[model samples]
Target: MGDLMHAVGYRKPLPVDDPESLVDAEVPVPTPAAHELLVRVEAISVNPADVKTRRQADPHGFRILGNDAAGVVVANGPNVSRFVVGDEVYYAGRIDRPGSAAGYQVVNENIVGHKPASIDFGDAAALPLTTITAWEILFDHFGLQPGDAGTLLVIGAAGGVGSMVLQLARARTRLTVLGTAGRGESQKWATEMGAHHIVDRHDLVDSVHAVAPDGVDYIVSPFSRGNIDNYAAVIRPFGHIAAIDEPTGLDLLPLKPKSVAWHWELMFTRPILLPEDPYQHELLEKTAKLVNAGKVRSTATTRLGPLNAETLRDAHARVESSATIGKVVVTR
Candidate 1:
């Protein structure tokens, strides 16, 4: 096989409402570096990040805009002996790197993992980005005990990241997860995904009171575009809150009364901030093992075939619509 490969890309930023934003094109099949693994992408999933990047694409150069993918490692770099050819893997690749909407992609072995054995490629592709975000928030940032059960609140608990947070908390910890959703379907979906309780986000504080009454031990804000101020009102004293979305004009003052610790879970910060950390890879490997063991499941819904511009555009539209749950994936 030659080095050239097909990929989905955008030459310039366009509104998702516009038709020219995503395009099918050919790009170089990147060669893995000494610490990298070359993956042949069988499936790729979409997150809100894909939509954000698409809207803010740099016109000066072409941008391949995808982050989560499941594939097989076809080659390894010079010092990369951990994985060999033909290993099926899944990962939410680094943010600073070229994306996974392609036939082949090169990623650091540190960030990739073996796909879960219980599911197909499409489902596995949906997990990496969301699971990594949720895991890093509860485990790395808050230092929550995996077995220490507590009253946990997951705001916006019907989306991709929220669903993963629910499953992970249920699987690893005995925490009674109280997830927030506005609609009936989302509420049912959250409950099915392992939320011990589901409440409407409309009357959040009141709804939480009816469920936990004592207040939740931890709050995961997988959605933070709004309601931060309202959340602090109900957060337990000396509790922890972790958020993973864009903070638009948030008031940090409300958290002072509760002695609450607020954290931001940007999964990309690790690879972007400390790219050489071997411990991150160890964590990813462990998470993958859990997935393979059937302890947790993948979290995407839309699975279109082959990576391309049209598929990407459609995925972005769904994400922006806020109606899509789990992950929107493009599989080969």
Candidate 2:
């Protein structure tokens, strides 16, 4: 390994169309800390988080912005016990660290998982972030059990996290899954992922009621703004609602009558706040097993190109458009 590595970073936030939004440069290769692994990044997938970070956060200096990655461990800290050199791994790395938008990155071993053997690096890269988010929302936040039978409504069902939620709910639980999509292509994609019914985003309350009149037992929404009223109307008494988006002026008083439970899910919480938690790694391992068993499949629908400033910019633009049908991955 050399002292310097190729990387894509930005000194300041700019529009994706700007040529300097993400610039190619050489940065020093970072060394692994205790319980950390130095990985040679092979593939990366862009998520809304990446776009949001680029648009809103002040890096203060050149900062690499990527979270979902599949790579091979080239080195490890002295205290690392979960993996060794040359192990194929995947993870949604911590936001506080230098990210995967470079030739190599250092991620803690406790939050990493072995890549599914059945998929390539690009496909594997698409799973970690969405998989972690969906799994946490379903099992952790919603407190769902294996034999639980009810209706689960997924808003923005064709996107990365929703796709995984539909698949995991079908494969691991007895719940009837319903997905909302605004377009025909997205509706079809949601059905293919395992949604038993497709709800029109425009007529959320009516369409969701048409499929499950009793009301959905659980609702998971990636796009939560301006939809809380519909969610309140369709959620049954004592039902659960989980949202990943940050919506301003969100009024929860509408759900007071039903005693609806609300949850906020952020997959980075474990890595950023509770670094000692091993559940994220275990969850990823379980997800990898599901992928290997063919119960869950990769949602990488668009491959921009190799990992570089140009491809990363394109990937960010696609995600920021809010029309992506699935994940956009860039390979090394």
Candidate 3:
């Protein structure tokens, strides 16, 4: 392996629109730990977290800001058992580590899964982070059952995570999926992604109540700060509310009256804290099965060019715009 490889990274925190925010440079090839696999990154998907992380990047060191990735395993650590050197894999790598913006990365095998055979690298790259998040939020947090009968409301439904949540809820469970989108295109995208009803983001509470007079059984708020109060008002008794974004000044006290359960889904939980948890691996494997079976499809709608400074900057800008309908992926 070479001592240094090409990568797109930033040395100092700056605005996403700044020309110097993301740069192409050379970085050292990382080695795998006992439980890690060294993967040659083929494609990467940019998420809102990438933009958020870049805005808070350290001023001293180069930070590679990417999370969703699909690639081939070039090498494996001594303790790795599920994957071998030639296998293709996909995963949302740990946030603490230098991400998949580079030529290669070291990720724990427990959090990685085999790439879906039916899709290309770009499509496969778009699934891991959002899929992991949606799966955990729906099944683990809300305890989704196959025959469940109720409405599931998803805030910001056109984005990557919400798209997955809509598809999974529609495919695996019998819930009526209600997705919120502000624009006309986003509403269409949400409906095509599996939303049974589209609620306007401008009038979240009323729009949701119009379709679901009895109130929704579950709420997945990908971006929930502004509507937290309304969420408490619209949810049915004993309903569950799951969120993944970082909301400020959030008060759950209002939910007490309805006996609503609040839950938070963070995809990095297993890789960062509970390393022994096999659910991430298990779920990714299941997601691959669902994809191959045509039950769920990729949300990668925008394709930026190769993994370079110009393309990455474009991706970051679009993500910061808060108007992207689906995942933005860049290939090697």
Return the top candidate by TM-score. Answer: 2
Instruction: Indicate whether candidate 1 or candidate 2 has the larger TM-score.
Output: 2
**lDDT by residue (tens digit), candidate 3, 1-332:** 78788888898888877889999888889889898999999999999889888888573688887899999999998889899999999999999888899999999999999999999999999999999999999889999877787889998888888999999998899999998887889989999999999987788788888999888999998777777789887899999999898887788888999999989889898899998787888999999999999999999999987899999999999889887889999998
Off by over 4 Å in 3: none
TM-score of 3: 0.97
lDDT at position 84, candidate 3: 92
Candidates 1 and 2 compared by lDDT, better number: 2
lDDT of each prediction vs. the true structure?
Answer: 0.82, 0.92, 0.90
Candidate 2 TM-score, true structure as reference:
0.98
Question: Which has the higher lDDT value, candidate number 1 or candidate number 3?
Answer: 3
Q: Which pairs clash (backbone N, Cα, C closer than 3 Å) in model 3?
A: none
For each candidate in turn, the TM-score is 0.95, 0.98, 0.97
Order candidates by TM-score, high to low: 2, 3, 1
Error of 2 at 238 (Å): 0.5
How well is each residue in 1-332 modelled by candidate 1, as lDDT tens digits?
Answer: 57688888788888876777888778888989998999999988888888888788574587777898888998899898568899888888886778898889999887777777778889888888888888888788878776987788998889888898888888888898998887788888888899988887878888898988888889988666667666776788998989887777777788898899989888888777777766556666777777778777777667786567776777788889998767787888
Each candidate: RMSD to true structure?
1.6, 1.0, 1.3
Clashing pairs in 2: none
